[model samples]
Target: MYYTDRGIEELEGRRGEEEVSFAWLSDRLRTFTDLNPEFETAVDRLATWLARLDDDEDE
Candidate 1:
């Protein structure tokens, strides 16, 4: 559930050509969800942050 397009690209770059694995994502999701039960809400916030980063990179 990567948010922004660029952020997804960055993640892919780091992970290489392989598709993101469920195990990898599950671990991260578990961490975030444990911290806050509203996982979807947190992801929306993350998307906004990534959008800002993309805008900043353009400037």
Candidate 2:
């Protein structure tokens, strides 16, 4: 498994049952980026990808 999968699995194992709103997730992402400015581009890309998940345009 990819290294990132460990964090993903931990997140699922720890909080998979919790339901959260996009607003809350957005706020958290913003906060994370604020604290981790180096990942701003990655976070922006991820947010864009998630926001466009249902779009027909090719990635």
Candidate 3:
């Protein structure tokens, strides 16, 4: 029911079956940040979290 859910659903509907490289995804994130500077912090947090998914520091 959240506002972002719609975007998430649209993304799933549009590209759920597609496979992309990390580099491509990074570029896309960069482009999105460039276009939406306000969301840069959120994007940076997301990227950092994703990059550390395998780290064992926190459970």
Candidate 4:
């Protein structure tokens, strides 16, 4: 498994049962990017990808 999968698994194990809104997730992403400026582009890309997941045009 990929190294990142460990973090993903840890997240799932820690908070999988919690329900959160996109707004909440967005805020958390923003906070993370604020603290980790180097990851800004990656966070933005992830946000855009999540935002477009339901768009047929993107597919």
| All models, RMSD in angstroms | 10.0, 2.3, 1.9, 1.7
Write one digit per residue (lDDT tens) for candidate 1, span 3-57: 6788778977987776766577667766877788867677657656755786876
Q: Which tens-of-lDDT digit does each residue in 1-59 have in candidate 3?
A: 99999999999999999999999999999999999999999999999999999887776
Worst ten in a row by lDDT for model 2: 50-59
* lDDT at position 47, candidate 4: 99
Per-residue lDDT value at 22 in model 2: 97
How much lDDT does candidate 4 score? 0.97
lDDT of 2 by residue, 1-59 (tens): 99999999999999999999999999999999999999999999999999998887774
Give the local distance difference test score of model 1: 0.71
Runs in model 1 with CA error above 4 Å?
1-3, 18-21, 34-39, 42-59
lDDT of 2 at 19: 100
* Global lDDT scores for all candidate models: 0.71, 0.98, 0.97, 0.97
Supply the TM-score for candidate 4.
Answer: 0.92
Work out how many backbone clashes candidate 1 has. 0
Model 3 RMSD in angstroms: 1.9
Candidate 3 local lDDT, residue 29:
99
TM-score of each: 0.38, 0.92, 0.87, 0.92
After best superposition, candidate 4 residue 56: deviation in angstroms? 2.7
